[model samples]
Target: MTYSSDYLRSLVREDRVHRKMYVDPEIFELEKEKIFKKVWMYVGHESLVPDPGDYYCTTLVGQEVVLSRSPDGNINVIFNRCGHRGARVLNRKRGNAKVFTCMYHGWGFKPDGTLAGVPMKADFPGGVLEERASGMVALPRVKSYRGFVFASFNADVEPLEEYLGEARRGIDELTDRSPVGKIEFAFGCHRYHFDGNWKLQLENQADMYHPAACHASTVGPDGRQFQRRAGKEGGDAAFFTANGEAVVAQTGVRGFLKGHSSEASLFDKEQSGGVWDEYRAMMVDAYGEERTRDILKNRRHSMTLFPSVDILIAQTSVRVIRAVAVDRTEIEIWPVRLVGAPDVISTDLVKYVNITHSASSFIQSDDLEAFERCQEGLKTEGAEWFLVAKGLGDEVDEGKGVLFGPRSSEVGQRAQHVAWRDLMGA
Candidate 1:
């Protein structure tokens, strides 16, 4: 069924949204064109392809794309399709190749995505080879903010920094945590898929209301007992052992324009002792005492960069959302390493990601169950709309397109739909 712009806008009301937004395949196709292609989407980080000739193949907006580092020390995002036979040029997930040779026809492309040579010179048209028109197509816009690469299919889209807006604070918080002010997507990643719309995962990142209930088993008394049995007392386990109500009460949610939002830290700064003290000293040695205090105190548990990316600040990982179908989504969690920090810090981060986001993890599995249930429940014909009225009228308008609300509020989810309507309607 074709939906008009007016109808698309009507699907998202102030306090409720039509269920079709989550279950309609046509709407998902429309989202690919109107929302995903028109915005700056996270592709991959520069660290993924640091050296010249290094390349990493990944998906963006349901299309195969590659990030390649050129000899000029610049990274380029190019379509992975062969210019000759339309076959995928790069099959490997990552490698160091000066030229990508198509498996089908042996057509070669430089790291910068310029046509280099064709297998048979007389077989191709003269102009196609001479004009470099047959080269793999490079994305129109590719930019990186502090090593985090983003690409847009729309050439006329807003600048990356302006697009990030207040969301830059989240990135800053992650990078500043490193004494050298640099972070890398090291320690590999954990990739998983769920039978649910991409928005469900996006909204859950900033959601504080569901933790007390949805994650009760993980953070409740029973889970604490299990942790105690496993001899886990401090660190991240402390966050799980804390009273659910007390944690929710102390946390706050902040929403920004264009569907960007962040959840305040779930736990306070670690008490100064043992490795914690050593870490604090390292930070103090790098940044002065005042700046170090500010950096350590202003903690954000997670930050959702509209459309596809969630920065798990405290866990030192990034979750990238990829929409596979209207009711199916793929998520990739990449653990980050704080450069110049102690090896133990990075090691602990990887361990935390394994316990919380791995396919067999309890926390992530519970959330996936909820997401699947939401997908199934939305299929019922009995309900036409999904209510998102929690904290609807109580959101404080923190000027400059930011909304401040209680941790349990749906302000972030509402803001996302507002941006969705705007993009889909346009």
Candidate 2:
């Protein structure tokens, strides 16, 4: 298989993606440039930086940036490099400070990327530093759609809202479902590192077909993909904890054109119709029966931010893929808190998801082994390409977009690859 960008693009035929897209280092670099760095990448939530001077540092795509509160109490994101020595100013993943000072040369910068202080004022040429030339490297642009913060390295990209397309509907569905029109993640984040490509996780999230095969608890020997075993970890039964459930019942999983897919099966009313007695009554009373039903009974979906931003369309939490190499990937998980939900509800949100899916989950341990083994096998001469031909000709392309089968098909992967081809000029 000659690995050309055009060839890679041609391999995505509605429901299938060629294996080389995941294995090619050159293609991975191209994606980092054309998709991840070029587009608006999610940073953190507004709650993370509530007060002026409060800040959280994180990577956008692969570029180091900070989500911080400006002097006027506005949340903004800026690159974390010092303008003088280029040393990392905000080294911690998150912190609170009036300004970030470079330890190397005593260069100081405000959250808005403005130069604040300079050591030994009378040192260089005119003995005065120019504000525009000496300030920290601010992002080309920083914007947020609701609470989700995003930044772009390139200056020519479209507005974040425009880039979101119909995906904005996913955010609306997620927020409107919450009683107060906003939601947050609990238990922090559940981080994961995959030996396989990070795209595998994106495809697996809404790829209903893989759950029965790739996930243990939900995967059945036949095609049921439900956990019936009480003994040893069954199929891909990666639970949030030992002897726990792994199924995340979002409202409904749906696929968007260009590799964006989501699931909202966890909407309680739709799953159980707000029928949990007092707790259900409380939710209904707070949000109203009809509103609660809309919140809980509807299928809320998670979305792929085109390339690597997997914004689980239904929750305040998100996973950003920080790809290190073609065969190695680091994922950062960030959960937000709902503005008005009960503590217990948010606690449960983190309990199972963090326990089962994060790096710490024993359930995830088995998944790691499998993905690592798959990586090892793919490197060998055994198979030239991995098969993504599931539900090939049977895709239900609605002219606008195709809906995948049971959240288990490779349609999402194909969608992403096709989008990738278009973006990279493959």
Candidate 3:
């Protein structure tokens, strides 16, 4: 659907958006250039490449980029394409590479993204190749906030902190929960793909109204049978109830600026068992009892950072979404470990992801099914618009670029499209 900028803007209303927004191939292509390429996207955590020469390969928008750590303790995010033959210089997903040597031709670049060696130095004029900037091209801007690294192709995008806005609260909560103010990304990530638009998962992550309906089997009475069979009676109930109640406890959704949002999902203290006791003692020693309680018990479920990733603080996971096409997306979920917390704390967090949101997770399967069905349904000629006016006029000001409303409100979704329209100039 070829659309003028004015027409594109017309499709997005404060309370509703055209169905084409979710189904249009042309709109998705425009999004890659107008939004994803221009925003500060989460690449990977600094812990992913802790040592010099360590690198992680990921994509920004659609272009492949490598996040590498230099010998001088600096991080560099460079295009993976070789300066010589335009082939990918790094093939591995992640590794310790002293220099990236393109397999196509023999071109090598240092971890700092500078040209290191050429296959035959004498083949070219002495300083001609070197003077032509023959090296991996680094991204224009890169920054880290609390060890979460972000890179931007746009040279003039706002600083990471300013861009994050109130969304920082959830991220800070994630890092500050660590007794020593540090967290580690898990060694491996669990990846899942869906036959749907990438925005489907992003929007679904914080949608409170759907869980009770979509996940009825997993969290309802049927779950008790599964719990009993696994000798884990009441475990499912405790998990679901704690998160479910926490969502209800919140007065509204927090729709922060730039399409970011977070919702509190405080878990019960008993769920942590002795692990919370040990972690709490450490935190209390570092901080007072009141602060310790606030740190451990004040849980934020999903921090949806626009365009790419969502930080799942309560569950100790970081979910990165990558769009492959108009109706294809890949999601990588990484469980994180707090550096100074008790070993059991890390185990519990990782196990939560496996049970609740992993590829085989009972709860997540319901969501995936819904997303696929929505994609299929939207393809048919029926609805002209997707309604997002829930609690439209009832939203309350939460101050600091945040709007709040009932848990079922589409405040987050409305805020998200607002950013999309502004970014896409539509």
> For this target, which candidate reaches the highest TM-score against the unseen true structure?
1
State in Å the error of residue 211, model 2: 2.3
> lDDT tens string, model 3, 221-256?
432312210112212333244444423334356678
For model 3, the local distance difference test gives 0.78
Kindly list the per-residue Cα lDDT of model 1 for residues 319-372, writing each as its tens digit. 999999999999999989889887777877787778888878867888999999
- Clash pairs (backbone) in predicted model 3: 9-426, 252-405
Q: Which has the higher lDDT value, candidate number 1 or candidate number 3?
A: 1
lDDT of 2 by residue, 40-73 (tens): 7777777777788887877765677888898897
Candidate 2 least-lDDT 10 residues = 227-236
Clashing pairs in 1: none
After TM-score superposition, what is the CA distance of residue 305 in candidate 2 from its true location, in Å?
Answer: 2.7
* lDDT at position 65, candidate 1: 96
The TM-score that candidate 2 achieves is 0.82
Question: Model 2: how far is 237 from its true place, Å?
Answer: 13
